[model samples]
Target: MLHLHILSWILAIILFFAAYQNFSDRQGPSQYFKPLHMVLRVFLLLTLISGGVVFFQTMGGGMAAQYGIKFLLGLITIGLMEMTLAKKKKKKPSRTFFYLVIFFALLTIGMGIWLPMGPISAMFN
Candidate 1:
């Protein structure tokens, strides 16, 4: 379970990079962006599943509260990212979308830092 948790975190980081790259590649003529986007979506789903498993396994009152907040933020981020992609496809990228992405990213990272000692702290410390 611990291994699964760590793997999920690592994969989440990788998916983050992949999603960013996909966004950057949107301005290019590459035929790979669509597939990459799909891959990122799949990765994000897997990350969520694994993270949920970890969450349920180690859940407590305080941690549950934190997890709920993080989960909501994550869903919001994912929705914003999807909307950004949609707007990008229409060639109408919005500054607000980018700001939302950045905001959620920072919030997620902050939540990771503030999470109780477990996989995250063990790896960082």
Candidate 2:
């Protein structure tokens, strides 16, 4: 589950940039991007679900603080992606929204690095 969560985060980052490029070109999301967008949405859902399961399953192991922060970052990352999609759907896509997605995705990915390593584990581990 942790591996899947990490994979989802990486894939979402790729999809976010791919979708962003279509908007960057002022062409909006084309057929290619549309599918990518949907896949990204699904992966984000998976990431959230898996994160929740892992957090709850291990919560009382003395790493609640780190897990809590990671969980919050994961939620915020999903929110940023949702905002990006919403803006694009409403025909109001902006660079700022795309940038937010990129920023949060990176943060989420960074924070999630420790998840599989046991809560507060270092990134290099």
Candidate 3:
């Protein structure tokens, strides 16, 4: 479940950039943009679902607060990704949202790594 969540979010981030790049390079909507965006959304949903399952499975494990924080940050990062793409598509300034997405994504990923349920933890074990 943890690996699935991580993989989904990583794919989502990649797809976000790919879609954004495709959208930015063309005056009209690119053929790849919508497909990439749709796939991104799917991965984002998988991320949330997997994350939620992990969260519930690990409830009352004394690190719930930290997990909750990471979850919230992940949610914020997802929202910012959507906002950035929407604003870009409308020819609006999305630079701030783009930066926010980067910041929150990194923060969430860092927290996830630091948590004791992931690859780093497995490595030490």
Candidate closer to the true structure by TM-score (higher is better), 1 or 2: 2
Query: Better model by lDDT, 1 or 2?
Result: 2
lDDT of 3 by residue, 1-125 (tens): 88888789889999998988887634856889899889999999999999999888778798999999988998999999999999888988888988899999999989988888867987997
Tens digit of per-residue lDDT, candidate 2, span 12-89: 777777765655336555778778788888877887888888788768778788788878977887887778777876
TM-score quality measure for candidate 2: 0.79
Per-model C-alpha RMSD? 3.4, 2.9, 1.2
Question: lDDT of model 1 at residue 5?
Answer: 48
TM-score of each: 0.72, 0.79, 0.94
Which digits, one per residue and each the tens of the lDDT, describe model 1 over residues 73-121? 7677767766766676566755688688778967876786677745467
CA lDDT for candidate 2: 0.73
User: Model 3 has how many clashing residue pairs?
Assistant: 0
Best by lDDT: 3
2 versus 3: better lDDT goes to: 3
